[model samples]
Target chain A: MKEVRVFAPATVANVAVGFDILGFAINRPGDEIVARLNPDITGLKIVAITGTGDKILPTEVLENTAGVAAYTLLKHLGKEDLGIELEVHKKMPFGSGLGSSAASAAGAVVAVNELLGAPLSRESLLYFSVLGEEVADGSFHADNVAPSLVGGITLIRSNESLDIHHLPVPQNLQVAVVHPDIEILTRDARAVLSDTISLKKAIRQTGSLASFITALYTNDLPLLGRSLEDHIVEPQRKQLIKGFDDVKKAALECGALGCSISGAGPSVFALCDSGYLAQAAGQGMQEAFALHGVNSQLYVSPINQDGVVIL
Target chain B: MKEVRVFAPATVANVAVGFDILGFAINRPGDEIVARLNPDITGLKIVAITGTGDKILPTEVLENTAGVAAYTLLKHLGKEDLGIELEVHKKMPFGSGLGSSAASAAGAVVAVNELLGAPLSRESLLYFSVLGEEVADGSFHADNVAPSLVGGITLIRSNESLDIHHLPVPQNLQVAVVHPDIEILTRDARAVLSDTISLKKAIRQTGSLASFITALYTNDLPLLGRSLEDHIVEPQRKQLIKGFDDVKKAALECGALGCSISGAGPSVFALCDSGYLAQAAGQGMQEAFALHGVNSQLYVSPINQDGVVIL
Candidate 1:
């Protein structure tokens, strides 16, 4: 095929409980990437940047997540000589803490794979996706990238092997996402966090994360709710987001099982048991943000089992 | 119901990846407690202490684990005026990191429950069991008591509400426990650990723990093996056990999935997939301890699915 298009779903990184190690993909707002094989072009080129957050995205091939992802894949395959044109249509908002960069990176790799007649496996593509992410953010963490590429909830075992495990998504689970009209750079949010955590708090986080995974497999809502607590990271990072406490309280009051900042945040997410509660929680979160003079976007989605789709 | 006898199984607390939250019951070498309701006594009394290592256990009613557990349960049930005589038949070695005190505590409370018309529920029993542990160890932790009372693998949610959850035990899993002739008090082992850990290390611990729980439900042996790692506690506490590194190496080389200090120290347990491997691993662990001029006792048993039983 001369051309291919792919859509990489947005992912909720950290998921409140397991920071830097856990994330889950979600449908709705995601990034669409179009890759075209062009023999006339000498190297990978960023053809266009469109959609909701186009103004913020870089059209330069070296700087764009999509372009960087395409280049990384071709280089790894020893086909860097191949010419490719890439377009990133960002359906999700930029710096929204919804894994927008990951979606763009994952989408570009998937599209490039399809354009090149499919040589790399989905697991292999994760390496290039992470490399793409490194160009956008200065680290090689795959909590978001793995889920955006592989779908469902993921645990990044180690960055060395890029080992990723897909955890079971409980049935009837709903996700309430609210993005406030504010930008908190991932670097800035991360900078606010302390380098060290008390041993007692660390042990609690380990227990909570383990419990959260077990709850997913057993479909125990109460345990899941109990396990969604983060004593280490959220307490530090929550300060970066405006009205974070109010948004979280509103969501919890609206029947969210748990609430916390999604990824590194200006955005927040709540886990609800039912779709009705999810919608209500989302509205509650938005209203809470509005009370602080912060307008917000809301998305109530089922746990997205399938990640990137070729459309 | 005037006289009741119960056996609470030994538990492997910490379980490598989860420091203060995870534990599993084992079949053999537990505490056997006999509780008798004698109106003539008018207060709790510790009548006897016997078996492997009884010299260290307290004989006084207020100081003895079994006596304290009985007293706590009776006081909670508003039946403190009822006279109770408790006998602690310590089948498990004391100060061995095999939950010896927890077994005595859990067994005594269970026997007292039977003798007192069985009014207390299992969940309610955890509160008193923790209180029982406090008498022996000076802190409230239910990782051992919960599994010993409730059976199988258990997670203690909160000490306040005494909320506990039982996790599914893999059918093919075996536990290889080796107790070297060394005493490492829980308080001392815990004291060696630092108050804080780096955020980088904390995140790794969380991922490992989550992987461990997921492995149990999925029966993923390799994942379980990989997840049996402790960056926070084991590294600091392992020094308390003689030849700890050699013992762990022997167990791992003998095909055990993972190996670490059972609870606090002195005793080390290795997880195995087969009974044959469990036996081999147990022998290897014993030999490793023997090389350091330490006598050791070995127990190879399947993960005990049933905790305490009435006799």
Candidate 2:
């Protein structure tokens, strides 16, 4: 194929108890990437970009997330001179904590891999995708990138080793996400966190994470809801997102199994047992945000089983 | 039934990645408690205590773990006036970090419940048993008590709420436990730990724990081994256990899946895929301890399915 277009879904990272370690992909509000072999170009170049309003995204090949991801993958394949032109369509808001950068990077690498006749395995593409993500946040974590690439719920054991595992998702598990119009920069959200936490709180967090994983394997929705607690990060970062507490309360009251800040926030996500409940929770969350005079967009989706797909 | 004699298996708490929240039961070296109706005694009494070798265990009803557990159960049921006599046979060593006190407490509750025609559900007995455990170590953690009472692998989500869940054990999973002939009090071991830990290390620990739980559910033994890491507590407590580093090294060298200090210290445990490998690893751990002029006892067993049994 001379050209390939792929859609990469947005992702929710942290998942309350698994800070910097767990994330899951959602089916909507994703990025689309189109990669084509350009004989006229000597190397990779960003030709066109859309959907990101006036929010200037770098178009330079080396500076852009899509270009950098494609470049990294091509360099890894010893095909750095391969002529490629890319178009990035950002369907999600930037710095929205919905893994916007990860979707673009994942979509780009996936598209480029298909355009190059799939020289590397899907798993082998994660490293380049993560390196591309590092360009946006300056952090080496892959909680966002892995789930967007591998699909479903992803647990990253170690970012240095790129050791990632896909956790089982319950059949009835649905998600409701509310992205408030306010933007909370990941850097600003992260800067509010403490360098150290009490050992008592740390143990409590581990218990929650362990129970949360067990709940997924056993299909125990109530246990999953009870264990979806963030004792360490959420307390510090919630202040960055306006009306996070009220939004979370509204989601839970509307039948969300659990609700918490999605990634660094501004966007809040909830898990529910049914699609109907997810929709209700999303509407409730939106109303709660409105109460705080904050406009928000709501998306209800099932856990995306297939992360990135060809369009 | 007028009388009942029951056995409660010893447990390995923490399990490397889940300090203060996770544990599993083993088949051998457990405490046996015999509870019988006594017309002469007006309340709970510790009639006899054995196997502890000159260690003065509390015989007072409120002070002894077995006595306290039985008393607590009877009190909760409004049967505190009923006459009951108990015989405590301690099969495991004290301060061995093998959940010795937990076994006694669990055995007592199970035996007394059986003697009373099983008035309480098995799940409801965890709280009384945990109260018994608190007499031994001033802390309220239930990692050991829950597993010894309920069997298999247990994850205690919240000790405050008594919210516990049993995790699946792999079919071929085997345990090798080595207890060096030294006493490391839980209090002293806890004292050496810092009140706080770096947030970076806590996140890493959470990754290991989440991965470990996922490995158990999927029966990925290699992944389990890789994720059986203790970054928070082990580093601080290993110095209290003689030959801990060498013994862990020897166990890993002998094809054990994972090895770490069990519970607080003095007792080290290893997980292996086969019974034969477990035995070999146990021997290697003992030999390594011998190099440090430490005498040790080795027990190799499968994951105990029935935590406490009536005889």
Candidate 3:
């Protein structure tokens, strides 16, 4: 119970068709981190947080997701004197719609649980990251966190009870991640959405959401592409992301199953049949963003099946 | 080919939360028909039509869904001289949420296709049935026909290419069907609906639709229950189906996963985990309907994975 390694997988939350209710965990490799039971006198502290720098905020239980997760563990186990430190490999980029913060929180919790003989159930431990999410985004939504903690696709469903489910990830499915060098804070991105949308539009949105999930389980690529439509949020948020339409069109033309803004914005994710097509879609998307004077790194990988794992 | 036996599975269309886009084939047995090839000279001639004569229209190209399907296939194959004699055995009750007509239409087309050596893929053959639905419902919708033909769950994404898919059915699932004697025509059921719904209401509808599909994939029953809500159509339509609220509440009280009007329905569907619970839900629903002076027949069955098949 001295040292442990837990990997948190990246996730796609608010997948185009299902805004808050749908999410999937990519089988692609994600952030890896090591958490150790340090014999320090600090009340939940990080010795040296790797990957992200000064912008990651003060490593205090109040501001840090990993710190919060550790604090929660200590509080639950009635071990206030115990100190823990997390070293995130940051394999998945932070703020890339890949549940970056959730990774930190989930990785911390999983590591601590492993270090302490794993007492809590997987769903029981997921709340720590969800609480941490409330710290940054006023609301505790777990579309990204749940999937990041437990691999495969996860759905937030109702905010109550924090239902976490790990769905099946179809084989050979690849997802292309393109992170544009732009930032649309989750809070800001959320604020732009309309409080009330037309019912016709809503039903159609429901249709698309149903179609998308159906397509995923049935492996209907074309249906998945068509189902990745957001009549409610995308229209309002697309203006926030420069050249979203052109980029999406480019991805589709390049054989991407579908393309949409990942999470709140800036980063875009596209589903493709093969790694080559995914890579092409990613590069094409990056180039389209360049047309709008935006440059970003492209992460071309397969779907992340092994959600959170220890390296 | 002298004899052709084709199968179309029973489908749950207007899937509680998903009005139009979501549908799934039940695990129970469905419709089956045998169409023997007969050489004739003129337009589609249904040499024989039997089973559920009360609901089925005569062999008219514009009225009978079966005739329409046969005609569509004959036109596509460019063999107007091909005579088809379809013998349909209706396993599902007419006017039930289960796609009874769609089953017949899909079965007929598939049987004909087999008799003709199946020149069209399953996806292409679905169009013939979908085209035939226009004869029954006055609109070309594929939600019912798609699942009946493809098996599993289906999503009618678009009419252009007839986007349909068979999604994965959740593990440990069963469905309870309750049909009231009071007749509810599809046209009348649609008549009660408000033509235009608010944008916010629309998004909520989409959320529910997303919720049902998400719940199915993740196997989150509670989430699925939460998502079994309708904002636009159900509210208005419920006024016509007496004891709707009471029956729905009774079914839910009896551990029913979710309950709603099945397709422009007077018939209601309740999903349950066990066959006993399913039967209980149906009986409880009947008792609830009795309070409103409406008598109903309840069918407790599992998800019919096998679509239409030959007898």
Candidate 4:
């Protein structure tokens, strides 16, 4: 195909139980990118930028996540001179802790790969996608990008070497994400975190993370619920997101198996055993946020089994 | 049966990647206890203690781990008045960081259950076993006892509620343990740890642990090898065990997948992918310890699939 359009799903990163190690993709409200290859043209070109959430993104190729991702892949494949034009459409809200930057980066690489005859495997594409995240966020973290590219639940074993694994996703697992209207910059959310944590708290968090992964394989919902705890990062980062406490409490009370801030927040996510619980969780979180004088939007979804897809 | 004898296997706690949350049982050198139910007599009794390693144990029922465990079970069963005589046999070395105490506690419960016509399931028996551990160690930690009781590798989800799960063991997985003739109390190993850890290190440790559990489920040996790292506890506690660095280096050089201190240490263990690697790892560790002027004993074993067995 000479050109292809791809959609990279939004992801819930950090996953509460695992600060920077775990994340999973969701189906709806993602970024869209169109990749076109022109043999006569040279290098990557930003053909256009258009979407509901485009106001917060940079139009410059070097500064944009999608452009940076395409450039990175082109450079890696020794095709930087090969003409490629990417039109990015940001469908998800920006800076809402829903992996907006990751979806763009993932979509760019996927669409470009399809446009270039799909030489790279999804895992191989993850490396370039993480590089795009580096350009957008000023750090190398694959927690969001890996899941967005590979789909389902992903564990970032070693982000430096790009060693990532896709873990088993439990059947009937549903995700409820409530994004508050207020924008919380990732930098500010990160800045509030303490440099060190108590060893006792660290042990608890690690145990929770390990148990959470085990529960996924065993399909133990109650055990999975108990494992979704984050004493290390959540306590410090939750303060950056307004009404987080109330939203989380409301989510749990309304039948969410567990609830916590998604990524750096302004977005909070809850894992539920069924669609019924997921809807209740979403409604509860929205009502709680409204009570705190905050407006919010909720997205209820099943675990996205497929990440980036061509359309 | 009026009398029954049981053998409880030794355990490796923490398992390098999970401090106080993960452990696995191993075959060979274990504790043996014989329980005799005497309807005519009242309360629990210590009949006799025998074995090459019995010198370290206390004869008093209240102070002895086996006796304490038996007594705890009888009290919980509301059969405190029923006469029970426990004869302890210490097969494993004491204070060797091989979960010697946990073996005695586990053996006592198993023998008593058999003597009483098996009134409880293994899972139900775990609570009384943990209570026995509390008496022996002055703390509530099931890392050793749970695995030694349930067999295979076990994750202690919540020690308080006794929520535990046994993970699958790979077919060719082997374990090599080298016990240096040195003792380091669990309390001393724990005291050296810093009150707090750097958030960076905590993240790495948690990622390692999560990856380790995932590797076990997927039977990914290379991934498991990479995950057997302990930046939080090993650095501080390794100093307490002599020749630990040399032993670990020797094991790795001998083709073991990974090596780390076994439990609180003085004993070091290596996980091997095959029997040949296990034998080589054992020899390498023993020789390394000898080079450090410490006498050592070696035990090569499969990942024990059975916890306590009646003979």
Candidate 5:
């Protein structure tokens, strides 16, 4: 194939109870990457960028997420000598905490792999994608990258070892996400957190996470809602996002099973049992954010089964 | 149903990553309780105590676990005026960290319910059992009581609300328990713990627990072994049990899937894929304890499905 284009879905990290450890993919508001053979150029290059509009994303091969991901994969395949050019199309808002950078990195690797006739397995490509995404936050966490690259609900048992596991998604599970017209840097979101937490809180978090996993396996929606509580991270980070409490309350009252900040937000997410309820929750969240004088974009989607896919 | 005898299986609480939140029942070395309707008495009474040599247990209705459980059930049923006598049989060692007190309470409640024509559902009985067991350690934790009452693996989401959930057990899963000839009180073990813990450790613990639950649902034995790690409670409590480190190492070396302190200390438990491996691990653990100049008792069995049963 001379050229390939892929869409990498955005992801919701933390998932209310699984801070830095769990995430799930959504179908829309992702990034698109186009990889083509450039016989004139010897290594990878970022030829064009679109859809980001004055955001001034990095374009250098070593600095750009898409560039780095494609470059890393090419290097691993001993194909660095191959001529290739990548065009990044950022469909999602930057710093919205919906895994915008992860979509870029994931899409790049997937497009490049398809252009090369798929030399590597999907699992093998995750390492390069995670490394590329790490440049955005300077952390090796894969809660966002894993789900954006592999889809469905993902669990990272050990970020150091990149031990990723895919959890079963209930058939009726849907998500409602509202990205406010504001940016909250991942570094700033992380800074609000404390180094130490009460042991009691830690146990409670573990119980919630454990129960959440069980709920997924058993298809117990009520249990999932009850378990989707964050005792450690969310409390500290929610203050950074405007109208978080009101938005969450609105979503829950609108029939969301659970609601919390998505990733390092300005973006808040709600999980619902049906598409209709997800849409209702999304509108509720948007209205709640607007009440705080914050404009927001809403997206309602079922759990994405495919992560990055060829267009 | 004038007189009823019931046996309550012993339980292993904590389960490595789920301190005060998760546990499972085992087949043998449980307390047996016999509840008889008495015409002469007008309230719950403890008439006989056996199987505990040189270890004096409380016989008073409020102080004794069995008596408390029976009295609580009777009171809840508006049958406080009914005549009843309970026989307390302690088959398991006290302060062994094997849910000895929980077994007594669970057996007492089950026997009393049976003698009263089983008016209360098993779910409703958990409250009385937990209250009865709470007197032993003065904490409202139900990790032990829930499993002993409901059987299989149980997760207590909230001790305050008495929220309990039963988890699925793999068919081939086996347990090996080694009680070193020593006793470590739960209160003392809890005393040595820090009220606060590092956030990094807490996240790691949640990841392990989530992975463990996934492993159970998927029937992934190797993943279960990898996730059966305790970061916060095990390290501090292991010091209270002599030869703990060596015993755990021995169990792992003997084909055990995972090994850790059973509940608090002194007694240790190992999980294995088959009965043979569990038996081997039990012997290895017993031998390791013996090398530390501590004689130990060993029990190996499959995951018990039936908790308290009629005798």
Candidate 6:
């Protein structure tokens, strides 16, 4: 078996009101896993597992995200009969909004593709990684995986064609992440959102999304801050998180551009102009959480320019 | 007496499904009238009239659109003590759906401002024109005025703030315009549209708008054509136009990118890729109208790069 290399990064989903549509990668590197082709094995299998959720499960193709990614890739490539051994390094926490499962899954597919000299394009692998997320969330959503796989803030115009896409990363922007010491299931969080939204609300959402894109292009801070508001989702989800308002207020007081629930909640992210402000916002959020009788950690990082990479 | 030069251009409104949100300017120039400040006149008076309905109406300060713009600027600048003489011209017919009122209003404001050495920002002047549109339409709507003043695809973000915005134009675009000799009053058209739209219909409208924006970004010609559809306004408004479907069919068959009612339109605009296609589309639409017993003229012009202008 020859050595394979794979890398994955953390991602932020639901960038403001663009629910299920917008996402981006963060500067901090995520988990990496490597797998090598083992020609002698019989059926599709995960010979080994590491990095994340390893204690909760075994090296099975059905339950494991990385294993599922490899299986799906093999199935798509018509090479399902080939056996492979995967080794993952769990660098980020499982409960964080940093797309832990996606990291593992993307890492697996990337490693396998690299070992085979890269047959699929980056977009194809992104699709493959999203399949792995379905095993964890009971639904396939690319809000997190696409940005982590592609790097920078991505607008998913449509998943089918993957033709209308681009990265709108504003220069000199920083991301401050505050992950509370609590676990909220993504499925449970998603269930609380209303299936119907008012036309007025929807119009506001569309206008803001357009403005956010425009601001990124124009590099206007105040306009970008205005676009970070979500009248549809954030108000309902704020109750799930302890001291969310205080943290948001603190971040705003500390000169953070905007703050909102990351992905499904329990984790919060703030946009800032510099590393100093990001750090301050993160610390403020952590302190606010502490006041609410929960210990939390913060990560002040820049926008991830490079997404997935092989090491 | 000081001479004031005011310029207004034609605007295409309701741009596809961006109903009440999107508009753009046209290269085909409209009326350009000069309002000269008069030392001999008192309490707002007009001195000269040329081109377009000039002799048909009162040159009273409150009645004339160009005169109203001059009054608005004078009022804002606190130079109301000085009397201004307005030279009015009507280059385009009022009911052509090319936003003749907006052109006259914007032209009036620009001419006055330019004569005054540009005391107000360009966007502010745009708002001044929007204000003048209220005298004719009974409400302030930036849909027409912004594009006329801005010279590109302008999206009205907010009228209260007077924050009219511009979007990037797609490349290799052609605009084929057909004017059927039919009059649809703005009031009648506005009355026909349902006050409230179904949620499903609204989403479809938004999707159409989003797809159009994405197509513009991706330079997807076929997709751009597909995205020109509108489920909300077109169905209700098409009943007013003579042989609307036939015109659309002919335009599409003639290699037009797409066709839609142009601003409460008796006129229709078809998008295409080149001059030849635009000309073909124009002729086909005219032929369709002729077959339906309606005489129509065609303008095979590209997307207007210049908004309102002084001719």
Candidate 3, residues A126-205: lDDT per residue as tens digits? 88877766665667778777777776666554556675445555555688888887777777787787766665576577
RMSD in Å for all candidates: 1.8, 1.2, 4.9, 1.6, 1.1, 3.7
lDDT of 6 by residue, B1-311 (tens): 55655456676788676777777777664667776766776645766666655336557778877677668778889877676667777777667788888887887888777767788977778767887887877877888888887777776655556655578777878888888989889999888877656544554555456566666656777877867877777899999998999999999999988888888888898889998999999999999999999998777666666665554
Instruction: Quote the lDDT for A201 in model 4.
Output: 79
Per-model TM-score of chain B: 0.96, 0.98, 0.90, 0.97, 0.98, 0.93
Write down the RMSD of candidate 4 (Cα, Å): 1.6
Candidate 5 local lDDT, A1-311, one digit each (tens): 38998999999999989999999999989998999998888999898999987789888899988888889899999999899989999888999999999999999999999899899999889999998998887888899999999999999999998889999998799999999998788889989999999988887887888889988998999999999999888899999988889999999999999999999998999999999999999999999999999999999999998999999
lDDT of 6 at A264: 83
Residue A235 shift from truth in candidate 2, angstroms: 0.5
Model 1 ranges with Cα > 4 A deviation: A52-60, B52-56
Candidate 2 lDDT by residue in tens digits, B1-311: 27899999999999999999999999988999999998877888899999999798989989998888889999998889899989999999999989999999999999999988899999999899999989988877789998999899999999999899988898799999999998898889889999999999988888889999999999999999999999989999999988889999999999999999889878999999999999999999999999999999999999998999999
Error of 4 at A8 (Å): 0.8
CA lDDT, candidate 2, residue B10: 92
**Model 4 segments more than 4 A misplaced:** A52-56, B52-56
Candidate 6, what DockQ?
Answer: 0.25
lDDT of 3 by residue, B109-153 (tens): 888887788888777888888888777778888888888877767
Q: Global CA lDDT of candidate 5, please?
A: 0.91
lDDT of 1 at B140: 88
* DockQ class, candidate 6: acceptable
Off by over 4 Å in 5: none
The CA lDDT at B251 in model 6 is: 92
Those runs of model 6 whose alpha carbons end farther than 4 Å from true positions after fitting are: A48-65, A87-97, A138-140, B1-7, B46-68, B93-97, B181-246, B264-266, B290-295
Candidate 3 has an lDDT of 0.74
**Given the true complex, what DockQ would model 4 score?**
0.77
| TM-score (C-alpha, index-matched) for candidate 5 | 0.98
TM-score of 3: 0.80
Ranking by lDDT: 2, 5, 4, 1, 6, 3
